[model samples]
Target chain A: MTTGAYPSQSTARLTRERFRAGECRPTAGIAPGMTQTNLIALPRDWAWDFLLYAQRNPQACPVLEVTDPGDWHTGLAEGADLRTDLPRYRVWRDGVLAEEINDASACWEVHPDLVTFLIGCSFTFENALLEAGIEVRHITDNTNVPMYRTHLPCHPAGRLQGEVVVSMRPLPAAHIARASTITARYPGVHGAPIHVGDPKALGIVDLDRPDFGDPVRIEPGEIPVFWACGVTPQVAVMASNVPFALTHAPGHMFITDVPDSRYHV
Target chain B: MTTGAYPSQSTARLTRERFRAGECRPTAGIAPGMTQTNLIALPRDWAWDFLLYAQRNPQACPVLEVTDPGDWHTGLAEGADLRTDLPRYRVWRDGVLAEEINDASACWEVHPDLVTFLIGCSFTFENALLEAGIEVRHITDNTNVPMYRTHLPCHPAGRLQGEVVVSMRPLPAAHIARASTITARYPGVHGAPIHVGDPKALGIVDLDRPDFGDPVRIEPGEIPVFWACGVTPQVAVMASNVPFALTHAPGHMFITDVPDSRYHV
Candidate 1:
């Protein structure tokens, strides 16, 4: 999906070139500052349910926009073309695992329509926290925000329903409060801590080993603050077991033209 | 639902008491220091569409919290009961005015299956504007903010769709800019101006004749700044012609515990 001509590679150009060359993988942290979104290329039949899914599960699915079918450019975010701008895409078949692909054109269909969802990513507020002199444990440890599947069920939208997934961060009590307050302002980025203390309360049994991502050390007085993770859509996608679906692998996010600051609640 | 309480009585208490007393009237001037919310209550059947609608049309529908069905306490705001708190409710059936009621208890069904939307109001920012020494035209004139139906189509949400409605205020260019920059920080209150200068650009034919609210004077050298208004939900709710719906009257709003300052984007 990223292949393109690079007359002169700039930050955006080089980044696009890398994606175009297939040199960039799903997890590449190539660019920063710009907003990153979640991708959901589903059949036209399922687009409505998926959109409802995002709306019902806002913390995990704070949608930036849904592009007009097959029209990939997100005018909200610097006219970035969703089809080719993204590093990669996945094809899901009726809730079943399907072949992973780089472009949709090969598998694109008018009836099995695809919708693009731009979700709020923590990367925006993670930057805000770091700039605010607050430490981001995940970045400090060079690990993904430890995500755990929770007992908290997402509000259902047709067949797209599943348990809420959350990412946890450990911080001192004061910083936890500060982070909660600072982050809550950006509703675009999951807005505040859903749970601030015991992981077991959210039904997770262990902190050292998460369902996804590496766990960081929790210092003496630090407590955990959990936020709804973007992985929620994948959970919903999986729960639906639709014949087809698409999502970015793990940390691979769809970069958007919207500035991180634009997501304030 | 207005039963068990004195209608129109001050309730000899605070916002909650007055509201609980079937004072479901204009919340515009109640609870001065407290935050007031705009309401959009829809049946659960249409929940996803309206939720998606709010998400797509944030400048106009910046959600404070989309409540979990049957459970009304926002847990974020003043923790007022969703079903009983607002002094009044307007029921829209099949896209037409059906009836105005004091409480939605008669309309309430368990699962009662419904979705409630809380939106930030201009009042929060108006206080800030007043404190900054800027004269709020509507407040000075003792009238609703001049609102008009714009040519802009609100990003559609299923069948739930309509044109964008903008509230306008005529102020000096410097004040308008400062107001934009200031309100730009408060995305909760419809954020900054969507358009400035020629109202026609937004498909507004006459600034003196508004679709809703009293028109304010536009002095020489003053420009009209238009912002996405909370009235948007009313337009969508009506335009969509959903089987059932509810919303607050113009200016009247639900007071919340959230401080206006907390909404700084």
Candidate 2:
């Protein structure tokens, strides 16, 4: 199920209930003031390694909440069921994409000891940048933010190892400092731009050709600023060939009841 | 072995080597410019719960580094051995204090899969406070900072649950805001004071008698300011009756090669 637009007035709980009822859509605009989280679930054995990986690479994988083994409930959202709450779920088997479905309840039967991780999403800070009168090109163009895999390797933890993946947003050179100051307040999300000007510095060859998401236009005086992407954890899962895993489909995030302000320092 | 005073000109490596060679003394004044960490080690099975506990109660237990299971190495201090690079350690069995030792190497044989966590200490921020021209009473008096076991229960994570423990410093009312703003910059360490005045609000009965450490004088116009303390995780271990655990003895912290400025925002 897909909706052209979700009601902006809807609360996070109501929005999650809609997703649970199979209303599949990206959660960016829904529950505007609430926090949206990226979800990943791994079996108990691999959970420790993944958690350590997140700890080591916090810029790319700022953790919001981690649920207990076999538990689907998260403290971030009251009365929400992780098994069927999100708009869509990706099921991975031995590191390869096995299936993309609207409901993940059946997948839990195969691996009952799955531990869920809710990670901070950049959408929270994008709101702050917009409030500070900084233009977010991807939001203006109504396209997914361009993300690329970089040569910069993430700190290895336990059995997990992967290179960094970053999301790019073109901003006017004048607004770069203001954008950095605003986003730095939200470290729970990917905080501040890692690289402000050159794409080659991060080993990216072209801004037009992104490994993930849609590319947006770069204005005459604008520079491409890159922030560590949440997808870096997904890359680690794939590169490490995790035996079994589940994650929210790209853009189809889990809207938590917690407000965006809670993450603001 | 005990020394009257460690030379202030020494580097963290030299200080750690001295501690490793059995120099029994408090670490606060030993490593003048480097970071000193509170250490805790737990068996593999209990590590997850304790990590979750710290995540849930970050104010009281800000985590600096977590070592891999059965790994004695920490990224915070290169070439520092977790088993012997501390002035002292406390070995606990079934939640009871079993032995206090200068070396933890012998105890590791029993729980070989132990995971070590290096936690942020108040001493890091206390230095900042002093630099900001705020008086640190305990340091001036040459006494341990007064700590109280509060009725404020930490948000429970997994099987680990405990009350919040706070370190009190009597400061002039005017310095409270500046102190908060200063410490808030160092989120890696315990960021800001949780309570500024009225000990009774935290269920703390008396200002003169603290549960741990020595009492300090509260001047006429000065008020008691309580910040979350590093002793919290140890309190959790005691409250949860953890089967096997090892922690640095109070004040006998593990000096790390990392500079305290690295913890400053």
Top of the candidates by DockQ: 2
Across residues A68-153, which tens digit of lDDT does each residue of candidate 2 receive? 88999988777899999999998888778889999999877988998999988887777778778888887787777788999999
Cα displacement (Å) at residue A76, model 1: 5.3
Question: What TM-scores do the predictions have?
Answer: 0.70, 0.92
Ten residues in sequence with the least summed lDDT for candidate 1 chain A = A1-10
Task: For each candidate, give the TM-score of chain B.
Answer: 0.85, 0.91
* Chain A TM-score, cand. 1: 0.85
TM-score quality measure for candidate 1? 0.70
lDDT of 1: 0.71
lDDT over C-alpha atoms for residue B89 of model 1? 71
Per-residue lDDT of A154-197 in model 1, one digit per residue for the tens? 97866678898888888888787778888887888788889989
Candidate 1: docking tier: acceptable
The segments of candidate 2 whose C-alpha lies over 4 angstroms from its true place after superposition are: A1-10, B1-10, B29-33
